[model samples]
Target: MVLPGKGYRFHATGLTHDERGYPDMNVKTQDLLVRRLVDKIRLNADKIILVDERWMEDAKVVVISYGITSRVAVHAVELAREKGIQVGSLRLISLWPFPEKRISQLAGKVKSFLVPEINYGQICLEVERCAGGKCATISLPHMGGDVHTPEDILAKIMEAVK
Candidate 1:
């Protein structure tokens, strides 16, 4: 089937790479496409800040997240607040480029940022970069595809506060 946003064409048949046990070239193409899609998502998100709030004029901790991951992050922030932690959240819908300026602004007010993501700390690196050394940053990472529990993230938030 033809894919949207890309061109498709027919070419003369070549050797049967997969039939001989060699990896299918299509698989590589698919990987490239996935990578491109991810890049696009990140680029689009560069300017958008999905969530923004400041609990105090000089809060010490801020949380940043994206997509389904963001839901759990919100929960964690709420729980942290209830427990008297001066934590705030900035949920990012876009992830590739990251929200650098917003993070820099947060760094001015907070001492640390708690980054939670489904992957094994990929986005956490970006958070650290955006933090610009104005604050310390750490991650609450989940390697699984599923979302992390609020208690899990809240626990990290608790740690960052200390």
Candidate 2:
């Protein structure tokens, strides 16, 4: 998460607070800060939004994953490839300020996206939104306590190709 620089301070209601400040309660101030942050993210997107894409040129299915699940997705992608499936992998290194443009571009090319996440489905929702109905977004959701097995993701990948 991003944090304000040291010695930075916050002001609210025309009163400056200490270094450890309270939330900015002013709507106008909040809006300005949010807009600035978004602009920064857009201006430096290439540096801020990091992703690792592999074997996408002729892929019918792209597996989108991140964090620990990304590690698992790697093995799954290898397994699918061994079976001669036209599958690819996209590992998200920066979750926030999502790589929407890349996802949207890929959505137009691929038949579907398989999102294997440890949650009930968070990032998968973002993938679905960015895909914009151009392609299917499948969520292989695991409700915590354990990560998805390679076979589980490979199964979904096979289903997606079909």
Q: What lDDT tens digits, residue by residue, belong to model 2 across residues 1-162?
A: 234565545433334322244455566766776676589988888788899998887899999999999999988998899889999999999998899999999999999999999988999999999999999999999987988999999989988999
Local error of candidate 1 at 14, Å? 24
Write down the TM-score of every candidate. Answer: 0.66, 0.82
Q: Which stretches of candidate 2 lie over 4 Å from their true place?
A: 1-26
Model 1 steric clash pairs = 42-96, 45-94
Global lDDT for candidate 1? Answer: 0.75
Alpha-carbon shift of residue 101 in model 1 (angstroms): 0.9
Worst 10 residues of 2 by lDDT: 11-20
Cα displacement (Å) at residue 137, model 1: 0.9
Model 1, span 47-161: residue lDDT tens: 4435555464546788887878888888888888888888888877655455677787878778898888888788888888878898998888888857899989988988898
Score residue 15 of candidate 1 by CA lDDT: 30
Q: What is the lDDT of residue 87 in candidate 2?
A: 96
Give the C-alpha miss distance for residue 22 in model 2, angstroms.
13
